[model samples]
Target: MNQLTVFEQREVLGKEFRMYGTPEQPLFLAKDVAEWIEHSNSSVMLSKVDEDEKILMLNNVYNQVSTHGGVRKEQWFLTEDGLYEVLMQSRKPIAKEFKKEVKTILKQIRMTGGYIPVSAEESDEEFLARALVVAQRTLSKKDEIIRMKDKQLEEQAPKVEAFAHFIENEESSVEFKILAANLGIGKNELLSILRNHRVLMTDEYMCYDKTLGKRVKRYGAKHNVPYAKYDRFFEVKQYPTDKINRVKVLVRPKGQEFIRKSLVKHGYIQERAA
Candidate 1:
């Protein structure tokens, strides 16, 4: 048996990439899908086929590919060897060899039915739930990923309520607006922080110094020591004086690993994550 490398194995498997754009014509493992996976993984996808010459090829192929490890790493992949093992043990009949089985699998996939289309004429709660799951599962798992995830949920969750209440009501008092402005932030920013992270929700919101702020004990205890709460927040400070000025120090809240990579590539920033 020929042992295929990772690149080659990916190429072989690329011949069966699933369709994401189409719902009604759902996933028949067509040419485009194959081409995508092949181009992505190249060598590793091809070397996993084994000859059993008995079971159905589609089941064999599905069984062979493992998606456990790579999914967590955001790759969502399976090794060629892993796929081969699945085919070997599958209840479906396998072709005499990997190449023959690959063809059979492709043909079977083409014949299989596609997804049932959902309509946008009316909103579906189930669809929303599924969307939430997808969003959570595929969310970027970086340092500030929680903030981004919360932002997504907060932004999307209000759609269900029709936002009629928040829209119809202009109840944000002048005091709240003054408070937000005092902190160099907006009312919405304060609201998001309070609702999502802080458990302090009240109609009578006000701006005050740390000594007079509600839950001052907890907040002070949490961020008491100098450079204790967030070292980087202070490290990034480029103020001429002791007070850190945010405008002078722009921090790109550590997005994807690639963002830092691109920044480093252009000499705009340096990696400080380590």
Candidate 2:
């Protein structure tokens, strides 16, 4: 005959109790219940009970021998009704709390439709069947995630390759280099172009006028110029100083294709002679 297996474990009053048997016919260790009761009410005096009374209580529950560390120990397991009878005998507040906990566990088991016990000595075929089911479920979820990531990469491949090609070629335009660097395309360039454009567009110049005796905005053609023409439509800032700062025009995404075609048309970026 197959023996009941431990299906769940719960702690009450700092003592752990193992729940055994199928979910439909749940059982708790008699010793664990006794300990819980004793901990709940020190006045119950369970230890003082005679061996005859203990045996009588044991008869109400199932007895099994569990081997631990090469030692066989007899364990008494009780049904819910038997446990309730035992708890009702005790007049402690913890006993009432333990009863409530038992009700919750029973309700959960009922809702879950109870747990089926695997045989202690399961056949290799049975074990493999269970393992395969779990492995299939895990692999199905992983495959779905991998497919989603692959699709994303596929959609982004052209953009990524175009940016990479722009960065790798030394002969590429300074504007492309700056834009690529700003967009985190390559590791060599510093200072993001996008951030600089926002800053330069919002930059305000103030000066103190002697007549006014207060700071006034410096209105000039350059100061009022649109952000798109900061560095001749490159959207990049160029500082006018003795040191030469190469400023390249910024091409928007919609205009990039047109620019490329125009360059080929003008023989700037030459196409292969077919």
Candidate 3:
């Protein structure tokens, strides 16, 4: 909710430059950068930069920059890439140090939200110590971001568990013989028990056969599954065949667990610990 200032006057090394835009995407006044690198009039060396990297902005937009003389109708600003390209043009010995100061000042703005120029009288040791602080702060920001992500995943834990429960209790299922194969048991043995108990059924019906073009009698594999507890253990589904439709009883994950428990209790199989 805090607003960021559009213009900042930063003293980099012994020279000064006016910075614009946010710390993450900083831009510089092309004229200031042009003079700092000692490009004295042969077009100020700014014209050497590629057209795409240099941009023209309305002076009135960043009013803080033009308070004294009022902003120009239009002024040139160098993009981050453009600034670097211009720095590489200067053959002056001080150009190398100027580049370093520009880099460090921008980094300080990003990490600390402000810049503290090196004091003219400060020892070399003091400068290094200050630079170290900036590096440490950047690392701390990265760690904070990682922790926030971990907390988000923790908050979503219950929703993920609920979805897994729904698969087991409702949607997940397999056909009768497929279930038998998955359970590593004999299909006919399980079929015989269910039929004898009247828990499942089969019947014969006739319908138009698409292949033979006639009504032919066919044995319905599953006429229907007689519900003992309202499909808690199994669901009856009718789906299309090549020529017609057929019924199938699908056993769910919950039903599979129930049957496995029953088999163990009856001594038909050993209880498998999972």
Q: Which of the two candidates, 1 or 3, achieves a greater TM-score against the reference? A: 3
Residue-pair clashes per prediction, in order, are 29, 2, 0
Task: Report how far off residue 41 is in candidate 2 (Å).
Answer: 12
- lDDT scores of the candidates, listed in order: 0.31, 0.49, 0.62
What tens-digit string does per-residue lDDT give for candidate 3 at 40-122?
Answer: 66355768889887765433334433322221233567878888888777788777887787788788677665566768999
Candidate 2 stretches with Cα past 4 Å from truth are 39-73, 113-274
Lowest lDDT block of 10, candidate 1: 1-10
User: Ranking under TM-score, best-scoring first?
Assistant: 3, 2, 1
Expressed as tens digits, the lDDT of each residue in 144-171 for candidate 2 is: 7568546755754565456446545533
Q: What is the lDDT of candidate 2?
A: 0.49
Best by TM-score: 3
Report the alpha-carbon TM-score of model 2 versus the true structure: 0.31
Q: Rate residue 199 of model 2 by lDDT.
A: 17
Candidate 1 residue-wise lDDT at 17 = 34
Candidate 3 segments whose C-alpha is farther than 4 A from its true place: 1-6, 42-44, 61-72, 117-274
